[model samples]
Target chain A: MHELTVDLGDRSYPIYIGEHLLGESRWLQPHIPGKQVCIVTNETIAPLYLSRLKASLDGYQIHTVILPDGESFKTLEVVNRIFDGLLESRHNRTTTLIALGGGVVGDMTGFAAACYQRGVGFIQVPTTLLAMVDSSVGGKTGVNHPLGKNMIGAFYQPYCVLADMTLLGSLPPRELSAGIAEIIKYGLISDYPFFEWLEQNVDRLLVGDQEALAYAVERSCRNKAEVVAADEHEGGIRAILNFGHTFGHAIETAQGYGNWLHGEAVAAGMVMAADLSWRRGDISADELARVRDLLVRARLPVTAPDDMTPARFVELMGVDKKVLDGRLRLVLLEAMGNAVVTSDIDTDLLAETFAACR
Target chain B: MHELTVDLGDRSYPIYIGEHLLGESRWLQPHIPGKQVCIVTNETIAPLYLSRLKASLDGYQIHTVILPDGESFKTLEVVNRIFDGLLESRHNRTTTLIALGGGVVGDMTGFAAACYQRGVGFIQVPTTLLAMVDSSVGGKTGVNHPLGKNMIGAFYQPYCVLADMTLLGSLPPRELSAGIAEIIKYGLISDYPFFEWLEQNVDRLLVGDQEALAYAVERSCRNKAEVVAADEHEGGIRAILNFGHTFGHAIETAQGYGNWLHGEAVAAGMVMAADLSWRRGDISADELARVRDLLVRARLPVTAPDDMTPARFVELMGVDKKVLDGRLRLVLLEAMGNAVVTSDIDTDLLAETFAACR
Candidate 1:
């Protein structure tokens, strides 16, 4: 197993990545304070892997809460449902919650755990490739509000994360490609060699090559762990990890959530950022084209939908969490595998870039 | 002004207590980061003192959101209204949220500020004595859930607290007595000299004696600030502050939230705890009688309602935030002005204590 510590002092925890790690009860047993465990999952993942997980939790009293799959279900009401289950099952503060699905389950369960009697222990058992490579590792747990995505949440860390690569085999092709967008993001933001490596092995990743997939997940987690360790609360350096998120969040809000997968919106958002970077003379046109080509090869969207206009995009981006003092601070590319936060970009260039994406 | 620090390292903040401090713009102006300010107040306080508070916020863009009075409005829906007001008023991260009312407004606005764009700055302008002496000073911010009270929230601190003693003059007799319950509680749990002083001056506190009220508020705040500084997240020593809260929360939940003031229920709950402690031989009968006499002289409830049965109280207490591993840990008095957390009390004795209270 490849272990990466997300060094957050007392709140720090380990992210274990490898094949067949889920069956190893020793790693999970110590973290769970009691014999009673409640595994939170969804309709899509429960049917496929619930039994295998239950087998691993043999000595403990286990219960399961299966929610419907999708972003729409991530609400305060749904969070209450998890609380009801825990309360009804007589689970106390010592009881542990195990999130056993993708990002939605992990986010919802992590939030539920955070508010359950002020806080409780929770473990991430991410099944989808997107969650395995990104969301599951970070302590950013919350539910989406109608006003904005992740508008209601807390920065509560999980006790541990068990990223079993074997679970990725069950993910749909579209979902797998969506996960690649974030993998590419890690490389684009800080690691040039990883970006070049992805360019060389894009095909192998597409066909479910286990070795390539494992390597990508580990590298992505390592990159994320380092950034999180430096700034657990996005006060400064951590904001850089939000590359494309400003535009990506705007697109998600404008298009309405669940219409486009988060990674898909982010995929197109990255291209917009790259183009804007080139227009500002921060990066060469060649680098922008390379970014677009990579997103295309990964089978992710590279342009915004026609219905999304620049005016709507601007309005939507105004409410983004990263915005400050009415100025839209965006993470723009300095070059391939390099980014910086800047609010000095010309308004005309930004409008043209949004128009081009649409 | 009396200044006390919460001492939470970088998250630490100062609590300023005095009469007419709200008009002192010098203390508040430095914390207001941007040109815009949003003051959140309830109907009762708005009609009386909003203009005076607004006058202090001069030379800046100011807006007001008036909510209905009472605990019923302390919901996530109300928190959303504050968010809507913030968005509609174009308040940004730099905009400061000033909570200008009682406990309900302080809690909901603090929560609203916590969730707006992940978080923003907030200041407490507590009007009621209950809020000034307790809720407003500590950074414990959250709204009540239908299933339980304060089931969903975060421990987000404020920039500063403005506990203006002048506002307490507008409070009703019942509200003033309710605030005294918490004041007496601080004396009961941590300060013996304060307890003796409260016993001698209970009549003066009931008649709205300004010096007695100010002294009580300052001492209670000092005790709470010290506890919060030692255990910000309630990991250990902080649990002692919930002296009567385990049973009081049950009383509040059982009677329904707005029926009795929080301090009244807590007053009755503390009587029961003192009786329990006496029965366990941890405290003398004279000390228990003194506790009841002080609450009674202050015009707070010293007996439980007729509807509350020991079985029902037990059931409700099970869901309290202090429960751990199926055990209900309660803060029981060891002697006058001293307490300890214990789960070893006899069930029969507890039932009898409930019977006696009813």
Candidate 2:
């Protein structure tokens, strides 16, 4: 197993990556606060892996909440279901909540854990590549509101994240592509060397190359951990971690949350942000093209949908959590492996960039 | 105005107590993050004081969300209404939420502020004595669930709390009595002198004597502020603040939320806790009697309803937030001004205490 630390001082925790880390009871037992544990999973993953996960939590009072799969169920009402399950099982603040599915399960379960008795211990057992590489690491837990995505949430850190790469073999082809977008995002925002490495290893990753997948998950977690450590609350330096999120979140909100996967929207959003950077003379047009080429090679969308307009995009971006005061501060690229947040970009130029992407 | 600091370092805020403090624009304006402010009040309090509060926020883009009164409305659904109103008004992270009602308003607004963009600035404009003396100062914000009261909440502090004594003049007699129960609680759990003062000045406070009411509000806030500053998350020192809450919350939960005021249930619970303490040889019969006498004088209930049985009370207390692991750690009195949390108390003694209270 490979371990990466998110050094958030007292709030710091470790992320474990390996072929089958979920099979190791040692990794999860130390973090369990009590003998009672509840594993929150979804319909898709439960039938396949719930019993396997239960084996690791033997000798503990285990309960399960099986929710329907999809972003459509990520609501306050769904979060309440998790809470009801915990309360009915008589789970206390000391009880641990094990999120045993992909990003939706991890996000909703983390949110439920955050608000349950003001917060309890929760562990992430990511079953999808997207969750393993990104969402499972950071403490950014919340559900989407009708007006926007991730509008209601808390900056709650998990006790530990168990990202077993072995689970990636079961993910659908489309979902696997979605996960690669975020994996590529880390390299684009912070690590140039990793971007070059992914270019060479893309085919290996697609074929379930175990070593390549492990390396990708470890690097992604390390990059995320460093960013989270510097800005636990997304104050300043942490905003860089949201490179494509401004455009990405708007797309998610405009498209109706479940219509498009988060990673797909973010993949398209990154290409748009890169083009906007090129328009601002911050990056070469070649660099922008390279970003688009890489996303295309990974089978991810690199352009905005035809129906989405600049005006609609602006309206959706208005409600984003990143908007401060009234100005829309976006995390734009200066170059690949580098980013900056700016509000001084000309509105006409941004509109033109959006038009080009569409 | 008299000011007391909550002393949480950078996150610390001041609690301002005085007559007509709500109209003091200078004190409120500096804390509001931007030029826009949203005041959240209920229908009962809005008609009486909205104009004065609005006059204080003259330059800001002021908005009001007048919700229906009562604890039943303190649900996530109501919290979302405030979120919807803020979004419609183009309120961003800079927009401040001013809670302008009793405990229900303060809780819902504070919770809405906590979850809006992961959290925003909140100012408590507490009009009811119950809110002024307890809920407004501690930063314990949440909405009620069908299964429990305050089951969903966060310990997010306000930027400031405005306790305006003048507004209490229009409060109903029953509500005023309910508020005094909490005032008596500060004395029961931590302050003997405050208890003596209440015994001497109960009539004066009931009739709205400015000096006596101010003293009660200030002392109760002082006690709460100190406990909150010491243990913001109810780890250990803060649990003492819930001296009668375990039983009280159970009563609120079983009787249906809004059937009895929080303070009323707490009043009856304190008497029960005191009786239990005496039965366990933790306090003398005279001390228990003194506790009941003071509650009776305040026009608060000193006993549970005759229909409530020890078994039902046991079931209710089992689900309380204070329970750790599987043991119920209740805050029991050792004297008029001292309390301790323990799970080792005899179950038979507890049953007798509940029977005596009934």
Candidate 3:
């Protein structure tokens, strides 16, 4: 087992990565301040792991809320089901909520915990790679609005995040590719060597090689934890973490939420951002090719949706959280393994990238 | 204008208590970090003060959401209206949400600010004495759940709280008395001298005498600010600040929210707590009589609804935010000017208080 702490002072918590850590009460119990436990999972995840998670929570009052599975279900109305379950079962201020699914469940449950009784304790037992690597590590918890993705939420950190690697064995192939998209993001934004490492071991990770998967998860979390520690609220350096997210959110918003997975949209978005970066003379054409080829090799999308128009992208991107004071700040790569948030967009270059990427 | 800071470390904000401070942008602009401003006021407040506020915010992008008035509308569905207006208007994270009504609007707006794009800056322009003195200062922001009052919320403070005293001139007599119920709460729970002052001047405040109202608002805010600063999340001593809330919430819940204004419910709830305190031998019969008399003089309810049975009280109180584990922790008077949270109640004594208070 490998462990790393997201150093947030008093709000700091450890992320444990290992095999079959779900049934172990030792990793979860310490963070639960009270005896009442509520497990929030989705229909797909609950049938697979709810009983195991509930078994570990023996001797405590337990409640389970199984929501419909998918990105489209990630809304305030759906999240309210968790609140309904908690209140119906008499979960008090000290009760702890355990999120047991992919990013959707984790996001909704963490957000529910953040709002329940002003704030309560919550632990994250991520069942998917997308969550274990990106969403679960940061304190960003929220639901999607029709207008934008993650537009309604809070930065409420979990007490602990238990990423049991064995759970990934059940993840679908397309979902696995989605998770790798975020892992690749770490390399593009901050760690070039990891990108190189992923280039070499891309096949092994694709086949669910245990050792390769463990390393990817650990490294991704370490990169995320470091960025989050320095800027918990995304005031300065943390904005770099959303390297492809601005363009990706536009794709997600354009395609409708559940149709394109967040990671898949981000996968295509990174390529779009790279195209613009090359046009800005920040990265060479060869470097951009390498970025595209890596995601292509990993079985991820390398182009924006054909149906999405430039005008649509502009309208959607304008409403993204990254937009400040009417200026659209895009996180672009200054060089391979380096990113900067810049509002200095050349409209001609942007139009060309939008035209070319599709 | 009398200004005092609610010292919450870096999250601290000033409460400007005086006559008509809302029209002065100096009291508001410093807290607004961006050009976009959204004023979340109910229909009742918008008709009264929205234009004056809009005039003050001349140079900024402004959007207004006029929620329906009264406590019944304080729900996640209604709060979502604020989110809709924010997203529709493209109010970015830096946009400051100005809550321009009473406690319900403040609670909903603050909660919306806490969740909008994870979090955003907000300023409170509380028009009611209840909001100006108690709810607006404590950083307690949330909407009520069907099962309980304020069962869901966040401890999000505003950048500044502008308590415009002159706005109270337009307040209805019942609502004005409701505000005084909270003012009297500050006196009974923490300030005996203030309690004596209220005893002598309750009539003056009831008649809207500016001097007496300002002094009461200032004193009430001071008591609350001290309690909130010491325990921002209600960890320990802050629970004392919820002196009559447990019983009061039951009454409010029993009456279906809007029927009993929050303060009216609290007024009755305080008498119930005083009754219990006298039975517990924490206060003399004379002191308890004084507590009841002050609320009556202020034209507030001194007893629970006749239709609410003790069984219903137990059911509702069990789901309160103050309940830790399964134990019901009641905030009771330790003396004339001090409060304590205790679970040690003789059922017979509790039954008698529940029976006798009605």
Question: What shift in Å separates residue A206 of candidate 1 from its native position after superposition?
Answer: 0.9
Overlapping backbone residue pairs in candidate 1 total: 0
**Complex DockQ per candidate:** 0.41, 0.58, 0.84
| Selected candidate, larger DockQ, 1 vs 3 | 3
lDDT of 1 by residue, A269-296 (tens): 9999888999989888888888899989
lDDT of 2 at A272: 84
Which predicted model would earn the best DockQ? 3
C-alpha lDDT of residue B180 in model 2: 93
* lDDT of each residue in A93-123, candidate 3, tens digit only: 9899999999989999999999999999999
TM-score attained by chain A of model 2: 0.94
Off by over 4 Å in 3: A305-326, B305-326
Q: lDDT tens digits, residues B61-133, model 2? A: 9989999998779888888899889878878778899999999999999988888878888999888999899
Q: C-alpha displacement of A198 in model 1, angstroms?
A: 0.8
**Per-prediction tally of clashes:** 0, 0, 0
Candidate scoring better on lDDT of 2 and 3: 3
Q: Which stretches of candidate 2 lie over 4 Å from their true place?
A: A249-260, A305-326, A347-358, B249-257, B308-326
- lDDT string, candidate 1, B259-347, tens digits: 98899999999999899999999889899999999999999998878888877887776632345343777899988888888877677
Could you tell me how far off, in angstroms, the CA of residue B271 lies in candidate 2 after the best superposition?
2.4
| Candidate 1 wrongly placed segments (more than 4 Å) | A249-256, A305-326, A347-358, B247-257, B306-326, B347-358
